[model samples]
Target: MDPEDGSGWADVSDRSHRIDDEMDRIVERLRDLAHTQRRFQDLLDAVMSVGRDLELPVVLRRVITTAMGLVDARYGALGVLS
Candidate 1:
């Protein structure tokens, strides 16, 4: 008997199983991405700490890099206000 028949047993189809598997894979990928993102944030924080501790010219560059990371932007700039 065809599973699609209205009067047959409530049978799940292979398409549904495939979709569930795809969804599971997507969820797992997102979890891994989140973990990587957290690690990047942690490292950025540590760099900022170093910049603060050293109080050197390179600190400004680190600040710009941190700001760019926050905005998901590839580039950043800093200017003195008049």
Candidate 2:
């Protein structure tokens, strides 16, 4: 069996296709991660702005919400009073 025969070529082609597909998926995930990071940064900035402009209770709530959102947590609490 020659190395360049149909079966060998098909095996190589299949492996190449799988590698390409995996690379494509990895690139897409990286892009999504980058986008999510930028969004998170924006949210952080918004939280900072709220904290700067609002009173203590509002600042604490906004900061907690921002933290929860970034961490994908459904709920959060902060002990800001004491």
Output the number of the lDDT-best candidate: 2
lDDT over C-alpha atoms for residue 51 of model 1: 61
TM-scores, all candidates, are: 0.52, 0.59
- Per-model lDDT: 0.75, 0.81
Q: Which stretches of candidate 1 lie over 4 Å from their true place?
A: 1-12, 55-82
Misplaced by over 4 Å in model 2 are 54-82
lDDT of 2 by residue, 1-82 (tens): 3676567788788999999999999999999999989987878686666757558777777778777777779989876365
Q: What TM-score quantifies how close candidate 1 is to the native fold?
A: 0.52
Alpha-carbon shift of residue 69 in model 2 (angstroms): 16
Q: Give the RMSD in angstroms, all C-alphas superposed, for model 1.
A: 5.1
Could you list the CA RMSD of all candidates, in the order they appear? 5.1, 3.9
lDDT of 1 at 55: 65
